[model samples]
Target: MLIGQYFQEKILSSVKCTDKGSAYAKFEWLFGKGLVTSNGQLWKDDRKLLGPSFKLQKLTGFLPYFNKHSKTLVEILTKFQHQATNVYPQLVRATMDFISESAFVQDSTYQINDEDNFLAATHMALTSFRLRLAKPWLAITPKIWDLFGLGKQDKICSQFVNQAMSEAIEKRKIALAQEQKSSSETGENHANQKAFIDVLLDSKSEKEIIGHIMTIFGAAFETTASAMNYTLFLLALNPSAQEKVHFELDSIFGGDKNRDVTLNDLSGMKYLEMCIKEALRVCPPVPVMVRKAQEDIPLDNGQIVPKGCRVVILIREILRDQEHYPDPEVFNPDRFLPDECAARHPFAYIPFAAGQRNCLGMKYALMQMKTCLAHILRRFHVSTSQKRDDISLINGMVMEPKPKLEIVLTPK
Candidate 1:
């Protein structure tokens, strides 16, 4: 790739990301001027405005929602026990419902497998965007894809997403207005119990509110679902690893399949956390991250990434590099033990990226992953017919296992 001597120094923390780049613009079709796609002052302001919602304390408030949905997911998947079933769709539905409740304070019926909902339209839009990004020439002038009818369905998907989100935003606005009026009349403020949508409504326009809601929905649901899918897939193929995970879950839950996963419980899941990290290392949700160079970056080998150049940080490649991770292809959770991780390059494992511009919802996503796995692994033993090397992968905003991941779950 580069001068071998400078390999370790190239990815240092000093290189700042300029912008999110063009691939993310496809998201603007639905998330108009929202957090993930914006840059400069707009992005900074939006990040500050929304940062507190994802803070650890606030995320604890979402545990009940995550646990409730995780139970629903387990119940639904119970119907498929002992049979090879693709759990990806069910995972997506569960996460979508969870996000809907957390972000909008509304219960989405998608968990009931209703495929005609707005959340379903969001899934369609993401597929279209991924397709658009695949064709470099066509994506350069995105409207050309529309001309070839490739974007017709995407257009319809966008319409569905926008219409649905807009209506939700309007309803939230009316509800907030009424609540505020009543609060003023009664001289009692309910500021302590405001929902995320309520906070966004105070500062953002209707379109911007819808945009950020979609941004959170699009990013959170799919990526978390993919991460969980890969984690389960890896555990299925490795019986020993699955047994270890079960051991940890059993030790923690103590036969309480329905117990709520507390912050302390999640913190104590050292080995399960390792398995999750290794899964992310082997198959990061977003494999390649793009950043525009704001300033020229000098390499130890004398090459310079000139200012304004588009820099592609291959996250999957980095995680797989043998120099950083010995026996990189292996699914060994032992590699993430504290001392082992401390010995490696800090940048070796960045499933969520690094620096100031990293994922804002990092804590929230991790909590969901840990909580959902706690619920499922405690109640069932997972098994599969696929091998790690034989699994097919597709490139999108998130990496997906192709041919669908079919696995069987047996009650513990």
Candidate 2:
């Protein structure tokens, strides 16, 4: 197990020393051979091909979808006002809707309808994927497991997700063709604002497109939702911090809660961004990351990692280390204040990991999260009876609150 900044920089920054660990192969069954599961040339090519879609400028185009779905989330939570509600599922659906509209150009009215088989199937599929990773026998005997009906649900869920995403890709292709034809006839140029799916459709095959879509969907929704939930839970337990966030939001919006969050507003949300960063520090969405050493890599501490050895970076522990963060258990947003952050070691706080293979959607996730929180906090006062010590996290692909993250939303 590796902890602290030096190892992070050495291992993650070295191109030849680490690709992805072998464990990520298990993700291929569910996420396909997308950017998350691919390594070497394939990973590089996919990253380059899809890179333009997530640029800061491109992300501004996604704000409308974020605001639209965040409004739907607030509306849905109105029914549970003053009642302690499990907001995780609602958050999951809201983020699912965000990714669907922004990335796939599909209208996923998950929040309004409250019934999404695709979302449920995705949950099941993730659970099954985790199970396979835990049990080596399950990974080896896929045919036998299916023959004995042991993997029926897993198979069904996987098939359903693939088919659904495949169909969405096809639908977008037809729509794009029609749009292009119309633009050609009228001499109108609509090329500046292409969705993520539109960019993929231009270069990738159907199978490859499905892979990338699933990769982004799988990476984006649940993890972003988890991060939002954790931040809210932390805020609920820490009213002062929550009030600070409210104050920032009020100052930014100037008592007008209904207006859309402009790019300038997002940039100006310094305090709220601090709370989000602190929440990420306290409870990162993904608790651990594994990287396999490709060659004999030497560490600063006079230790050598032999070739083909798997190294686990203890993100949760590293974030809480006293070397970097003092009184790390305390919920203090000031830890991320500009001067303090400048004083700290760069790799000491890598919730999104570090290096070339760092999360591609980091910027996109932050934008969506900030927009959602700005909307939620502006309209409601969040509180919870649960204390930080009482919370137990189940560490999986994402670190989730074990029982559920329950909070009471009292409208301001």
Candidate 3:
């Protein structure tokens, strides 16, 4: 296992080091040959082609979708106010809604309303994936496993999700073709406001597009939802920290809690951003990431990582290192203040990993998170009796609080 910022910078920044680890391969069944599971030239080509869709300026176009879904989330949560409610599932569905509109240009209210079974299928597939990872004996060849009916349910769920995404991709391709014909006739251009699927359709085959869409959507929604839930959990445990977030939100929206969050409003949310950053540091969505060493790489400790070694980056340990963060267990958003952040090593706190293969949707995730939190905090006072020690986290695909995250939401 690789610990410390020096290794993080050296290995993650290396040109030859690829994310073709065993853990990543486990995702191939669900994510296919998407960016997350891809390596080498294919990964590079996909990253470059998809890069423009997530640019900071282009992200501004997604704020409306973020705000709309966040409002829906507020309405949904209001029903459970004054009672301890497990909000993680709701947050995940809301984020699914956000990604559906922003990335795929489709309405996912059916999933949110439980009319569609996509979310349940996804959860089943992920649970089975984790189980298979834990018990290697259960990870037999697909044909043998199916013949024995060992992973029948998981296989069905995986097929359901893949089919759903495939259909969505095909539908979008046809719509894009018609839109292009209309635009050509009218001398109009909308290259600047293209959705993520639209961009992929321009340069990818249908099968390839399905893989990219599933990969991007899965990565974006699940991690963002986990991060948001963890932040809310921490804020609920620490009222003062929660109040600081409320104060910052009040300063920005000020008596108009129902107003949509503007780009300027998002930029001005310094303290809220700090709280989110601190939450990420405490309980990152992905606590561990694995990258395979393509070639022998030397470390500052005078040891060389052998070629083809599976190097594990312990992100949770690195973020909580005493050398970098004092009183690391404390929930202090001020730890992320400007001066303190400046003094820390660049790789000391990589919630989204770092270097070339870092998360492409980092900016988009943060914006969606901040906007959602702003909407919720502005209208609701979230509190929970669950203590930090009582919560057990499952460090699987995404770090999830086991037994669900139950919290009370009272009107502000």
**Stretches of candidate 1 above 4 Å error?**
1-16, 113-115, 140-143, 174-194
Q: What TM-score does model 1 achieve against the real structure?
A: 0.91
Runs in model 2 with CA error above 4 Å?
1-3, 133-137, 185-188
Q: Spell out the clash pairs found in candidate 2.
A: none
TM-scores, one per candidate? 0.91, 0.95, 0.95
lDDT of 3 by residue, 1-412 (tens): 5656668899889876875677677667777889889998888988899888899888888888999999999998888999998888888888888988888777768335775767778777667767776765666677755665756886788778878878888778888889899999999987777899888776888778777877877788888988899888899999998888888888888868899999999999998999999999999998988888888988889999888888788898899998988889998899889999999898998999888789899999999999999999999988998888888877877887877888899998
Candidate 2 residue lDDT tens string, 75-124: 88889999999899899889989999998666779877745667777878
Better structure of 1 and 3 per lDDT: 3
lDDT of each: 0.81, 0.85, 0.85
Error at 341, model 3, angstroms:
1.1
Among all windows of 10 consecutive residues in model 1, the one with the lowest summed lDDT is: 1-10
Clashes of each: 0, 0, 0
Backbone clashes in model 2: 0
Q: What's the lDDT for candidate 1?
A: 0.81
Question: Of 1 and 3, which scores higher on TM-score?
Answer: 3
Error of 3 at 280 (Å): 0.7
